[model samples]
Target: MSDRVELELGDLQGGILSAYGKRGFPFGRFLLFHVNHPAAGRRFLEGLRPLVTAALRWPEDVPKPAATLNLAFTFWGLVALEVPTRTLRSMPEAFIDGMAARAAILGDDVGRNLMHHWDPVWQVAPGRPRVHILVMLNAAADREGRPVPELEQLTRLVLALAGQSEGGVVLMEGHAGADPRFQELAALFAENPDGTRTPLPTEHFGFVDAIGDPVFDGQYPGRQEWAKCIGQGAVDGQGNWRPLRTGEFILGWPDEGQEVATMGLPLDFSRNGTFFAYRKLHQDVAAWDTWVAARAAELARLWALPSLEAATATLKAKMAGRWEDGTPLVRAPDWESWQAARDRLATASRAERLAFLTAFTFADDPDGRCCPKTAHTRRANPRDMLDPWYRDPDPRARRGSILNDRRRILRRGLPYGHRDDPSGEHGIVLLAYCADLSRQFEFVQQQWMGYGLDFDAGNDMCPIVGAHGPDAKFVIPAPREGQPPFIATRLPHFVSTRGGDYFFQPSMTALRMIAQGMVDPT
Candidate 1:
């Protein structure tokens, strides 16, 4: 019995496969809420369902609709609403204990990672329960207008629904996304001539963001990119060439192991649902500029480069594993080659650019010379780069992209705050989706981004987003074997987490059960 018929595309929400894809919106916010009344909450949740975006098929000619809204519940939130005890017990321990429970496993510092930080607006102080549900609203913007109207209407609708019900409380959580004071900060990562609808623009760091996301079941209609994006998901005598299985990301489907995932005992309730990690990352622009300027100059002198700016840019690319424009080092190993790729990409169509941008892999550049093994991109995605990092036991697992296949995350986030303010509130609001938070999202954060054991560079960390206290180093050996290696140490923090939590986006069927009070223990 295939789960597809049981959990059809229409059963899921659009946010699962849409973010950063063709359906991606320019603006969005996560309105975190809590249940004030359990009895009334059941009624309220059912009412809110009408507003949730369904897995509707999008056509090529018609632009995918904007002003999308989705709902995600936390373990505490569900408990607050009096979920069936038997059902809760069936859930994985990881989901019921909440994201904080997995903090230790994720190797996060209690204070630094804010594994326990609550929303400051609530003044709940430390060690208190945070909000339960997250109302994710997404929309696009034009030069003259942002998507504030759609978001405002949707927010008001949620409040109105709660007003009549005795169960839920609309949280007044203050987020930078809705506040006017951070308007400049809001548009920080946005394109020029603000509020205009643009497709996945670069972040304040002055580089393109969100590329090479995993390709899944072609949910977004009239799109061929998703199928082609996998870059040969399989392997043969020639090389690997196949897309990852859809089940690896979406629940109730066969994963890379060729087995369907089990979402607790009642497969009907959790089949089409997935997990999410919402992070508010604050970028330190001033620190990055100051540190990079000095380091690039030093590199120029050591490598006998042309100028400080040139060397600095190259050094930045080395750290990120891609050129500022999003070209991978494997495709263009040197500054000169990268510049040529950049120029050619400029004239290509958007479709051509996106395909070209993510087409390359580490199969050819196994050595760190082309793209450093510890580089941010290589560490984060790896993509047929590592030599059996996970425990496979079987010798046959020594090769291919199976090691990092399940680790892929569907990145669906936008930049927040404006670059206008050097010290102002600005950075990316990262929203990543995966079937297993422990294996995918948290794994990348701990093993790949924060540390460097997988790359064989010792404890060396990702230069761009690694949280290694105040002092850290990013070492790059000279492109030529004999030249002196360039070492950039004492990398002041370029990014930090403000506050965030994990969420469980349930299927529409599960939502109906909760609303009708049909969730009693089986």
Candidate 2:
């Protein structure tokens, strides 16, 4: 094993390592900008530089800020800022082409997900200004978990600075249909009798989300960090878990492939930097609920389940590879087991609960008995199932997660709009961060989620987030002896792509270089 890489937290952006929602900032707004004057745009970036949050860990004595800010730029945005030609040319092709241009490959070109059907902001019309930069603002909720007044104040301040008469940047419009300025993001919350709100882990589809994010090296402090990597990071044949290589996520470091991939012209320009795929996924809650209800009814009779409630819960768990409460199906295969696990979790310590939720492997459930091979979670990560020697009869011969370690991505962002209003525009703002776009983010989106050949389910898509048509189907293998598999046919399009784009969130050093126009290819 190589020496562990030490991350320079101060040089990296906070959004790369931290999910702001979990850090007390559950409410956020995404603002887009178009730069018309290169020099003036540089001045705008220089003024906002100090406000951008770094990944440095907060001290125990110090309180976190009320809000956090981060910035990213598209390829055209770099050009608008007059970035050196050499540095611009060095960027990956997938990013330079942008998300809309690669819609077909990402399975976003069909039906409502097509480029034309996306938000007007993402569409590059003849007379409209093209999107160049993305500004993310995450604000802390009040004691009652309600939106604070400071959020709006901070948003207005930033908008005014960007749209100032002398500034070169223009705030883009037409997000989320009615909201022409910026898109608002908030997590789902439960209301109490006292009028207090508590954020929930469930998404619009009712499945517990934001679980099992990849743990890379230097993400956490101390020896305990290794313990947190179990089932969440790379695993050896002996089932020993450890944080994945730093280069797998951050630039200018050795990746799982044992090579430091070529970045832009200067090393400082790319070090600690990462690429982001900003996706706005609109979920059709009415369609999802109606489908789940009908499927649960049929499954109740076919599986001889006790009640409609049990069948409903079981069918959902199978589809998501976890119960609605975030319990992995591999850990709690049935309704009774799920209930028991939930009961245990209610009293377990914080550490114990974290272990229970993430510590599980697909080694024992090879045949998709407990969790379906094509289930959303299983297909998304695969864990040790993709190991070269996974099928060896002797468990000792199985190598662990060698192929999967390279494809991991850091997931950020939160749910947007109200979940109760199903017909209203609502879903998740998914942010995926990785060092390599094509190798990591694009590959998973295209191969794993879009196609099912790796799982031996040819032409089938991921039941939950896959881009398959209405004719697509999902297979849930029988869990016990003498029980037949339940096949869901003619699946509906539950999720649609609203809009998105690819961007490079540069390191603090790179930001300074861009702000001062100091980039030199020579």
Positional deviation of 108 in candidate 2, in angstroms?
Answer: 0.9
Candidate 2, 1-522: lDDT as tens digits: 435557888898887777988887889899999999998888888878998889887764235778888999999999999999999899889989999888888898787688787778888667978889898999888869877787787788777777663658889888864577888898888898998888876788888787899887788865546888887988877788888888888888888988886677787888888898999998988888899999999999999998999999999899889899889989999989988998999999988998888988898898899999998899889999998888889889988876688998888999998867634689999999888888889889889988889999998988988866868999999999999999988788888899999999999999999989998867
List candidate 2 segments past 4 Å from native. Answer: 1-4, 60-62, 165-167
Worst 10 residues of 1 by lDDT: 180-189
Q: What is the Cα-based TM-score of model 2?
A: 0.97
- Backbone-clash count (model 1): 15
How much is the lDDT of residue 70 in candidate 2? 91
Query: Model 2: how far is 138 from its true place, Å?
Result: 0.1
What are the runs in model 1 whose C-alpha is more than 4 Å off?
1-7, 20-24, 60-64, 110-129, 166-168, 172-200, 218-227, 232-237, 388-398
lDDT of 2 at 141: 82
List of clashing residue pairs for candidate 2: none
